[model samples]
Target: MTVTEKDRDILARTLWGEARGEGLAGQIAVAWAIRNRVDDGKLKSWWGEGYSGVCQAPYQFSCWNKNDPNYAYLSGAMAIPFRELAQCRGVADQVTDGRVPDPTGGATHYYAIAMPKAPAWAAKARQTLKLGGHVFFKGVP
Candidate 1:
């Protein structure tokens, strides 16, 4: 894909909102999952189109949800910490440019392990990789 500056910014904000507390590897893993969705031909109706569309799709990334705790920071209504946002932007740039290998094994979905129950969708998908506090999955119909 032809990633624009808006795409890069959206990806960076997503990384900051979703995986800021995780290590570098964890953030990249999450980014790869989003990239995987962008590459999914079957999901073009909703998930494909561009990084911004995929990341902001309703219910896809909770951090973009208005009620989500990270919404303010992600929407630019609040300031994100410089250090964390910079780290996310660096990783976003590298991964989007193919400077880093995908570590999620082609996963298109993940959820933090801390959730009380795994989502219904994950039950039908194959577990691909686990990084930091999240579990990644692929092969979902």
Candidate 2:
């Protein structure tokens, strides 16, 4: 399906395992996405199998830097939309060092995921990976 018609959904698949810690948050954070073939209990079935949880809030992402020597040089070589990059940054935020790029490639917009108990970043990465993209997780960040 085209990115525009994705009807996208985000799921936070805790990288460290957010199994209820302190007042909240636990060991890890992750996100995931699932669409088109639903079996009613699909989400619940995959909750632990692959998905850690879901992100029920807005996320931030960018694509340029004005202070850097490469000012106007798309942040991290990202020239995609804030969301397209957001899907990448969400995961990169916790996976890579300084993955959060500057917001300048496009208009900044926020969208909500259906999952509240999960990290939104992880969920977005999963969706992009499913589309044949490579997402490397950060080590011991």
The numbered model that scores best in TM-score is 1
RMSD of candidate 2 to the truth, in angstroms, is 16.8
The per-prediction tally of clashing pairs is 0, 19
| Per-residue lDDT of candidate 1, residues 14-127 (tens digit) | 998889988999999999999999888888797857898899999899999999999999999999999999999999899889999998899999999989999999989999
- Candidates in order have lDDT scores of 0.92, 0.24
Model 1 C-alpha RMSD to native: 0.8
Error of 2 at 103 (Å): 29
TM-score for each of the candidates: 0.97, 0.17
Candidate 2 ranges with C-alpha deviation above 4 Å: 1-79, 97-141
